[model samples]
Target: MIDARGPEFAQVLERCTVLLGTLFQTRNDILVFPGVGTGGLEAAVVNTLSPGDPILVATSGVFGDRFARLAEAFGVDVRRLSIPRGRAVEPEQLQEALEENSDVLAVLLTHSEPSTGVTNPLAELAPLVRERGHLLIVDAVSALGAVPAQTDELGLDVVIGGSQRAWHMEPGLVMLSVSERAWDASKRARLPRFYWDWRHAKNTPDRFLAPYMPALGLFYPLENGLHEIDEEGLPRVWERHRRLGAFVRAGVIARGLQLFADPAYASNTLTTFKVPDDLDAGALRERLAETHGVLLGEGQAELAGRLLRIAHLGYTSEDEMRSTLDAIQLAIAAERADDPT
Candidate 1:
């Protein structure tokens, strides 16, 4: 690993920040931290909100729920606007919540939820929060590169991202694009924070140094990944993900499997399907990995054992997806044949 404090590393860090700004479509300051996307979520929470501060969370799936829980852990009064699972949060729902919770300091939203393969209607939902003069914090970990965030145009105050998602980089790094309003909130925020302080992260003598020792190893790869995304062009990359999502969804339906997400708001980065009542989701995943060498994600929390998630995020190919689908068909066939019923 290179020395994080060195001039060369500082240069690399600056370049990455600029590239990340392009990715988020923001002119705001970008901060890097040495942790996963969750850390970025926590940083957004601690830096902009205080204990007992009221905020509205629009939750559609697991990640949205997780954001609510994270804020609650900080003693924030979280008013949850729960959308039905497999459905996107409607703009009207958010408007209603904001109207009811006028005291809310900010609004938390998940741009793309991996658990249910649903991407919330951020473009339509963001203005509701902004028009009301509330800070808008978004968990864009799964959406940034795969979909359009338009952080600046949307007036999003804080947009969090992770390296391991669409960037195709290794985990251990998280990035945030912070608007000036978020910085203003930070000045008044009463939440206890040290490592996650945005000021420390921004005001360091060398603007590139993090609050603590940085993830020295991830910077180069992160830069390289950003360059690759830049070279491919954002529109083309997004279209590729869109096509992949369509292909997977169509292939799954053709195989006689049912999708779990609403077709109107299905995620372009991943797809989730309802597992047949007779097949064990975990066993099918195991068989896919062990017998077919294809891995898929299991449903989380309440949906566990009843849903299957297939990711087509970064560096995925149609050939690979076809193989995965074939493996799923074979695994299901084998499992049903052995069913004593």
Candidate 2:
């Protein structure tokens, strides 16, 4: 049914409406979706930058790390400000990194690092980028909807979002924003692209917002989700994420687990904690799910097995967080009883 060309066009417009609402929420102009999250990142790197263009990439966790890798993949010269996991990048460090790269075209960073449960200071980062006359590209995929971003005031040139996160929609749909500077840079960049050309997508209204036909069925659910956020009020939805995150973190600390992130910078969508060195983190996750039917996220890279992530995002509530914490404590106690060392 969706394969029909006529219906696909209308659905594509619906997709655009949903995307425009999400991107505009960040307060940026000219939203684009080269493909999805990764595609949006690629387009940012390829379209707005020439090979060997200087750029500063702020890396705190997995997504920020991906930004550096993607920049290098497009042959852009990358200068990294390596903030340690669980910490936000200070403005002073960004100043130092920028001073070292005088020709920087853009500064890339994640608004929220889902892997490390760290939310960086994008409000601070954006102005610094603007002061240096460099565009700020934000990976707000996990931050948008779940977090509050005043895109216009922040001076961010490009912002990215994915449908799977707080948007509460199916994957495959992605959102992006482009500013005037980013659009101007497109003229000189020589990256090989086909379906990802933003100029083409922007010009050809008939082909929909993207160069290719998208997942049309996703628009139906995505529209519903966006409308739900609109009705609830975006700020109120963000407040829900904030309050639940704090409640969960408080409960985790109450249960005697060490929080992995600084409370000031802790992501309002999720929290991570270091399992007591004596406890097996992997076993803790399993018993919680098998015994209590509660699923939680695990850490990545160096944090794997050392930490466990607790998500308080996406249609979750305070009661749910309390129950999740209760289950976690039970799981740990059960694991200790079965094998005490």
Candidate 3:
């Protein structure tokens, strides 16, 4: 319903929320704004709780670690549950953390840790937070469409999504859903917030649509992306990701490469592998892109020189999978040839 002249941003925002709800399988409305998944996280923290509020963070990777830092920046009291990089935090550990921190107002969790390719057990973990009288907020940016997330059924208080990871779109906009639990908490939060504030944006439509200009063109492609998911169905989409993940993992093992994450906790959307000591993943990534036209993501931070990531999400095909394997084989062979010791 966007016209070139009148209230295009308003109409686009309306459609955007519907498309996001469909993508995330949520009944609540989604907010659209500048920045990617990180922006959505900021909004959730700034609006839903106040300074000095006790927050419990479950971190298994770099992105999860960011939640702790951001919460601290807002002057919130943070109790952290840090797990090994390649392993998911157990439900028992989370339960213990909550037990020890009885004053925790909220719990932050990451659904999929793309950095280490680990998937947390949110379904099992949410109930613990609820039982302890704490709100659960999930950073499901990578898991949202790529993996299955039933937000309402899981009792998640807030969930965040993005366009780049699973939606197969540009990275400017982030989508977030606020549950009734979070809505009630926001009533008493006294945090200083402006662009990331949810009060005015949630209660007043004009405030949401006025100064904040909507990304109109992104809406068109997001609609297309949601339609693609609808056509395939969420179950089929999840099955495809799992199948592809297995295919890629099998290929890596066949080539004698070591997997970074444990088999049971590994993410189905992405697979991280420890680069063979004989090979340089950075150079191999460049060669694969230049020689084979296959673009793969490199590792980050502490994992930089050690791991390589395969992103098998969103409109991914089996043919592309085969091509990627072939390209990786070529890179491995080339590396082995250079130093056949």
Candidate 4:
């Protein structure tokens, strides 16, 4: 076990944390916590917003809704501006929401909607939030490592990410970067928080320790993953995901399956497709896993059993893409043969 306070562990922790800022192009203060990505999101809100504080949420998919729900659960006044389940939020709509709500403290968004595989145009949306004089907080858990998310450049107040997605690391670590404005908001925020308090993370001079000890198991994998990212370089990694995403989407289109999200808003990290109406999505997934050894992500919430999501993230190669496509095609073909349609 490594000492959470020792210099050796501190060095590695800093290395991993710095890599997140570099990945997202941010110079803001960062906090790396040991939990699911949602915890980081909760930290973002609990640290910066108080009860009844109004926040506008621009949601295009399930995760964005979840962020808004978290705000509502904490008694924050949530103003939802939503698109369909398989779409991206438009800047104009968010601008309209800002116009409608003059007391909004922040605008919450999901950078990449993994449920429907849509990546919102943050560069366009952030300006709208900033123009309205509100802080922009984003859940980038599924977007950061696999796509071009210029967080600081867009003037975002907080960008949250998880280690597992597109980072080539297992779950257990989540992180967020905070801007000067976000820190100021936290100082004024009256939310009750102990573990999720941003101060505990930002209090120490080095910004390494949590309120308690760090996750030693996650720390090692995170450090190694950061080195892997550093070695590959961000541009190359993003381009690879882009090319692979197109490869997956092309294969899906060639198979005559419809994409769940619009092509323009499709995510480079994952692609979602409309599940054939005649087939049970659960059966399809089970056969693919039990028979073909291919595990696919299921649809969430209302989209469950109606959508199929596939990934083209870090460490996934062209060969794997071909395998995934072939497996999906075969699964669909088998279902058709059984139904005679």
Which one wins on TM-score? 1
Candidate 1 at 238: error in angstroms? 0.7
lDDT score for residue 206 of model 1: 56
Residue-level lDDT for 65 in candidate 2: 88
Query: Can you write out model 1's per-residue Cα lDDT over 82-147, one digit (the tens) per residue?
Result: 988899998888888889999999999999999899998898999888888999999999878989
lDDT of 2 by residue, 83-185 (tens): 8888988888888888888688888988989888999988877787898788788888887778876676776787777767645677777767776777777
Candidate 3 accuracy as TM-score: 0.92
Q: Is candidate 1 or candidate 3 better by TM-score?
A: 1
TM-score of each: 0.97, 0.93, 0.92, 0.96
Q: RMSD per prediction, one decimal?
A: 1.4, 2.2, 2.4, 1.4
The lDDT, on a scale of 0 to 1, for candidate 3 is: 0.81
Deviation of model 1 at 51, angstroms = 1.5
Better of 1 and 3 by lDDT: 1
lDDT against the true structure, each candidate: 0.90, 0.78, 0.81, 0.86
- Comparing 3 with 4 on lDDT, the higher-scoring candidate is 4
Those runs of model 2 whose alpha carbons end farther than 4 Å from true positions after fitting are 2-8, 11-19, 26-35, 203-210
Better of 1 and 2 by TM-score: 1
Error of 2 at 58 (Å): 0.3
List residue ranges in candidate 1 displaced over 4 A.
203-206
If both were scored by TM-score, which would come out higher, candidate 3 or candidate 4? 4
**What residue pairs are clashing in model 3?**
none
